[model samples]
Target: MQGIATQLKETPEGQISLTDPDARSMATYGKGTGLVGYNVQTAVDTVTHLIVAHDVTNIVHDRAQLAPMAKMAKAALQAESLNAIAD
Candidate 1:
């Protein structure tokens, strides 16, 4: 148990998964409900309806990922200025 506790302290979220080291706890839409997994963020082209930029992360909160994803999409599309829509 001490070994597991040590590992948990090393992680930013203070949790560790023995099954998948990279996986992290992610909360769902329901209260007190969550799962251990990764979050995938994608930036799709509105005009072409194709994926422009994508990323996978163990971090749970997606609210902070909007700007980074938008920038990556803009670079991938090679656009001078771009509009972003995120939920």
Candidate 2:
């Protein structure tokens, strides 16, 4: 308990995942429901249907993900102006 407390104190989030170091407590699409997982961001090309850019975050919410992913996809394609859509 003391060792875990020490580690948690050193952690930025003040919490630690003993099972999976990279995993985090994240909220899901359903209300009042959540899971321990990771948020994966991926940008896919329309024509090729291939993933152009990818990233991962421990963040629980995805509201701030679209713009960054769009920029990544745009930069990867080297396009002057690109259209990004998300549901």
Candidate 3:
């Protein structure tokens, strides 16, 4: 375990997850509340409420996912343009 510890020490984030290498620590609503997992992003049609596109990433939040997901959904549907909405 010393080698793993040493590698983690050298990393800029200083985070190491043994259970799942691809997962990361993510923040939640309450103070000191967090979870370790991948973030799942999905785009759906409002009328049909059917999933159009999806992506799994290790990013901690959804702030940066809107445009990329919209583009993906657009490509999936072969649309000329897309109007995306997020909360």
Candidate 4:
């Protein structure tokens, strides 16, 4: 937990405050301080409503997560390549 707190504190952009380390804003609901615990990503099939991929990260910024998460998701789904998206 302390390591995560340190990471959040040192992150340069969209640094999530650690005052309350277990809270976060919904993607389309409520107001958030751009602070909180984890960054989670999920990729679901529109047709089947099944989660094809997902990841939970301690880093705050979304910018750096794209490539890593995409790679992880591809590996998890056993896909050669993927068209990844995030918000």
Candidate with maximal lDDT = 1
Give the per-residue lDDT digits (tens) of candidate 3, residues 15-35. Answer: 877898878888888899889
TM-score of each: 0.89, 0.75, 0.87, 0.50
- The local lDDT score (0 to 100) that residue 58 gets in candidate 2 is 93
Give the per-residue lDDT of model 4 (tens digit) for 1-87: 998778877756534544754445324345643434677877775557788777787654588877877787678778887787677
lDDT of each: 0.92, 0.89, 0.89, 0.66
lDDT score of residue 37 within candidate 1: 93
Query: Clash pairs of candidate 3?
Result: none
Cα error, residue 51 of model 3, in Å, equals 0.2
Per-residue accuracy of model 1 over 1-87 as CA lDDT, tens digit each: 998888778878888888998998899999988899999999999999999999999978988999999999999999999999988
* Winning candidate number (TM-score): 1
| Stretch of 10 with least lDDT, candidate 1 | 7-16
Off by over 4 Å in 1: none
Model 1 C-alpha lDDT versus the unseen true structure: 0.92
Spell out the clash pairs found in candidate 4: none
Superposed by TM-score, candidate 2 places the C-alpha of residue 56 at a distance from the truth, in angstroms, of 0.8
Output the worst ten-in-a-row residue range by lDDT, candidate 4. 25-34
For candidate 2, lDDT tens digit of each residue in 1-87?
999999999988766789998788786789988788899989999999999999999977788999999999989999998998987
The best-first sequence of candidates by TM-score reads 1, 3, 2, 4
